[model samples]
Target: MKYVIILGDGMADEPIEELGGKTPLEYARTPVMDDLAGRSEVGLACTIPQGMKPGSDTANLAVLGCNPRQYYTGRSPLEALSIGVDMKEGDIAIRTNLVTLSEEEEAYEDKRILDHSSDEISTEDAAVLLEAVRKELEEDAYHFYVGTSYRHLLIWSKGSVTELTPPHDVLGQRAGDHLPAEEKLRAMQKKSYEILSKHPINLERKAKGLNPANSCWFWGAGTRPSLPSFEGKYHKKGAMISAVDLLKGIAVGTGMANIHVEGANGGLHTNYEGKAQAAADALLKDGFDFVYVHVEAPDEMGHQGSVEKKVQAIEYLDERVICPIREALDKAKEPYRLLVLPDHPTPIRVRTHTSDPIPYLLYDSEKELRRIGAYNEREARISGILVEQGYELIRKLFEN
Candidate 1:
């Protein structure tokens, strides 16, 4: 039987007053998901292990049936794999984001982190800005490589995996308070602001009223990673469709095929239909046993704290991604088991990842379960089917 997982990253949320006291999932128009909930096994799964940081790196590993405590080396290492960074022992990989910092403060420390994603700056423009930083700061020990959009990578030779706060976690907060404790890393970040704040790119962005990619925030530090092959462990030749590097890195490490779709940016306006079509092709034409489709729009909107956009993103996932994949499978007369869920909650209230158990829907094409209410946090919780171990949730999809 064919298997499919449609992951809406950070799709879960708490009740928002602006959303009429309903979470985005509850408030949004997700008719497709809501309809499937009637015949699907709907429940909650704790994607984040207890005490682990509620980041996508750890949660996704859990969702894919790999225990984070065992397989997760670090977040950047996974992205490094996607960037094709051949990390050596003792070398450290750090995520370098082209972020926006408040320009009012003369001292970099006093400035606030205005935007973690720098208004989701284009990768072409970001690459140019990163190149400038590379010329000024890159050395034999430290090197910068541009990834998707605002996400980039920094490989530090013989560097420590120092604790650094994610910029998204402290949005609208004093930048100095969250700077890395390591003096050298902190110094580099400070230097990055100096190099980018008054650059031509910043001036142009300012003219256009766009958040300037004015600083480099480093976080998610780690060494090289080693993950067991998905095919070997699950006996399914899997494929991954995602716009972000992190998911692609996981696919790289897990021996899964990374299906690239043109114009599939990790943003609200990304090509959702392209991702859906790619998954359908991988399963129907490529002879792949499993396909994991990840959509990042909901997570991005959640980080921006846009309640309306987050709701719209969920609707897009329902209409443009989930609906198309299901239609393609049914048209092909394929017996498939489809699983839908989020890795974790990037709550609109908190504007960051939360260690909350996310709701999930498991549907089999051949068999229909008893009807449940619409797919939302409340209904999933009411179903009384809680998977305490998130990694085991994947096993349930593969077996029976």
Candidate 2:
């Protein structure tokens, strides 16, 4: 038996009056998913511990069978690793965002847009700035490199003290003034500002009228993490299908292959169907027993409070992605299984990833269909399986 895990990033909801008091999931006409739920043993599973309000890093770690506290180095460092950036101990790694800083206003990381130029961060532009930052902004124990747009990786020397939060999470929200990691980190942020403030890079960007990512707002600092592979646990080749660098990094770190396809984007504005098909095809051709597909657009739509878009995205998955995969499985000469669910809820109310456990449906010929169903979390509790966590779900899928 093979496992196909389809994770809609930030998939979950709050009460939407527009749907006559139903959450987006409940209101959306997910006929394909519903049909699968009917044919297969359905279940609502917990992705994380209750009341913990874990981030994607923690939740994904859990789903992959790794304890977050034991192994989560940080999201940005994970992204760095996905991008082939090797991190050493004492290296302060940050997930930097390309942002526009205002000269007339006191700049904070949240003020800048998390995504510049939609979702595409030009490699040439990123490389140029990375070189400049590496050349000019050298503190005794600090170094830097640009990751994706509005994202970067920083390394601080061992024994250097720097106290600061990684800038990746502060997107369009208020990040409270937490104490810096250490003096070194604080100094690094300051020096980064000093050099980047009206520096040639920014000036050139300004002259070109491009978004100037002036100062570096660092967060999620940690050394390299040690994690065991899911391959060992399940004894089957698996692949992580995601556009997010962090997820890809986790796949790479855990000895899984990451299939990168063109026209795939992690931002909310990208094409959802294209991504899903690419992932499904990649998994099918590679003979991977498990394929983990993650979609970020719905979460973005939820965060933006675009109920219509969220519903549409859900339907799109059902029509173009979910339904097609089901058909593919039917056509396959061998039996297969598909698990459809979300990692966490990015409610329209909260506009950020939340710890809400998501509803799910497991489709296979062996499992009997059930009448108990609803796409929402509460309703899923009475659905099929309803396991406590995702690790056990994946484990079960691989067991057969």
Candidate 3:
């Protein structure tokens, strides 16, 4: 039987006053997911382990059946793998985000963090800006590699896993308060701001009323990780379809195929239909037994605190990604087991990931459940089926 997992990153959210006390998932028009829930095993899966920070790196790893407690190392190492950076033992990888800082008439310590993603800047522009930083920062021990827009990588040879704050976690807060405690890393961050703020690309962005990719905020550090192959674990060929380097990296390290959809990007305006087409092709035509599809829009919109946009993202996922893949699998006459869920909740109020169990729908096309249901978080709560170990949920999906 074929298997597929659809993950809407940070899709679960708390009820917002703007949403009339309903989470974005409940208010969104997710007809496809809602329909599937009626015939699926609706439940809650705790993707983030207890005492673990609620990050997509940990949650997605668990959802893929890799226990983050056992196999997780750090977020940046997985991303390094996706970007083809062969990390040596003791080598540290850090997530370097090209963030925007407020240009207020105040000291740098008083300046607020305006944006974590710089308005989801284009990768082409981001690459150029990163090149400028690379010229300044690259040393024998440190090298900057450009990943997707706003998301970049820094390899610090023999570097320690320094604790640093994720820029998104401190949005609209004074940058100085959250600066890294490590002296060298903190100094480098300041130097990055100095170099990036004067670059022509940022100047042009400023002239166009766009957020400048002004500073490189470093965080999400760790040594390399080791994950067993997906095929070895599940005994089924698997493919991952996502625009996020972190997900792609996890697939790479797990011996799964990373399917790159041409127009796919990790943002609200990314290519949803293309990602759906890629997953469908992997299952129907490419002979893969399992496929994982991840969408970033829901999480990104949540971070931006846009209730309307978050709802729109969910509707778009249901319409463009989920529906198209379902149609393809149906047309191909494939008997498939489908799982739909979120890694964690990036509530609109918090604008960051939370350690909350997300609702999931597991559907088997051949053996349909006759329970009436809707696919949102509240409905899953009503179902009363809970999987405490999120990694084990994949076993349930793959088991006959």
Candidate 4:
């Protein structure tokens, strides 16, 4: 039997007053999801382990049946794998985000972090900006590599993992309040601002009213990572389709194929239809038994705290991604088990990841289950089927 997982990253949310006291999933137009819920096993799964930080690194590991408490090294290490960074034993990998800082303040510390993703700046432009930083700051000990849009990597030789706050977590807050405790790391950040704030790119972006990627914010530090083979454990070759480096890195570590779709940027205007078609091709034509499709738009909109955009993102996932993949499988007369869920909740209210149990829908093509309400948080909760151990949910999908 073929298997598919459509992961809408950070799609879960709390009730928003602007959304008429309904979560985005509830408020959005998801007719395809609602139809699938009628014959699917709908429930909740706690993707984040207790006391663990509610980052996608931990949550996605749990969803893929790898216990985060055991396999998760850090977020950047996974992204490092995607970037093909051959990390050494004592080397450290840190996520270097091209973030936007308020330019009105003279002191670097006083500037607020205006945008974690610098308005989702193009990778081409970001690469140029990173090159400037690399020329001035990179040395024998520290090296820089550009990843996807706004996301980059920094490999520090013999560096220790330092406590650094994610820029997204403290949006609209003073940069100094959340700077890394390590003096060297903090100094690098200040230097990055000086280099980028007045760069030609920033001036051009300012002219166009775009958020200038004015500084580098480092976080998600870790050493090398080792993950068990996914095919060995599950006995099925799997593939991953995602725009983000973090998810691609997990695929690299687990020995799964990372299917890259052209134009698939991890933003609201990402290539959703391309991702759906890629997953269908991997399963139908490529002989892969399982495919994991991840969409990052909803989570990004949540981080921006836009209720309307978050709802629109969910609608796109339903109509653009989920509907096409399911139609292709059915047309091919394939007996498939499809699972749809989120890794964690980047609640619009909080604008950060939360360790909340997310709603899931498991649909079997050959069997029809008792009808459930719409595929959403409230209905999933009412179903009363809670998977306390999120890592085991994949087992249930494969074995059942």
Q: TM-score of each candidate? A: 0.99, 0.83, 0.99, 0.99
- Across 1-400, the per-residue lDDT of candidate 4 in tens digits comes to 8999999999999988887889999999999999999999999999999998999999999999999999988899999999899999999999999999998956999999989999999999999999999999999999999999999999999999988899999999988899999888899999999999999999999999999999999999998999989999999999999999999999999999999899999999999999999999999999999999999999999999999999999999999999999999999999999999999999988899999899999999989797848999999999999999999999878986
List the pairs of residues colliding in candidate 1. none
**Error of model 2, residue 10, in angstroms:** 0.3
Provide the overall lDDT of each model, using Cα atoms, as 2-decimal numbers: 0.95, 0.66, 0.92, 0.95
Alpha-carbon RMSD, candidate 4: 0.7
**What C-alpha RMSD separates each model from the true structure?**
0.7, 3.8, 0.9, 0.7
Residue ranges of candidate 4 with Cα displaced over 4 Å: none
- Across 145-218, the per-residue lDDT of candidate 3 in tens digits comes to 98998999999999898778999889999999999898888888888888998899999999999999999999
Question: Candidate 2 — number of clashing residue pairs?
Answer: 26
lDDT of 1 by residue, 1-400 (tens): 8999999999999999987899999999999999999999999999899999999999899989999999988899999999899999999999999999999857898999989999999999999999999999998999999899999999999999899899999999999899999888899999998899889988999999999999999999998989999999999999999999999999999999999999999999999999999999999999999999999999999999999999999999999999999999999999999999999999998899999899999999999787958999999999999999999999989996
Error of 4 at 219 (Å): 0.4
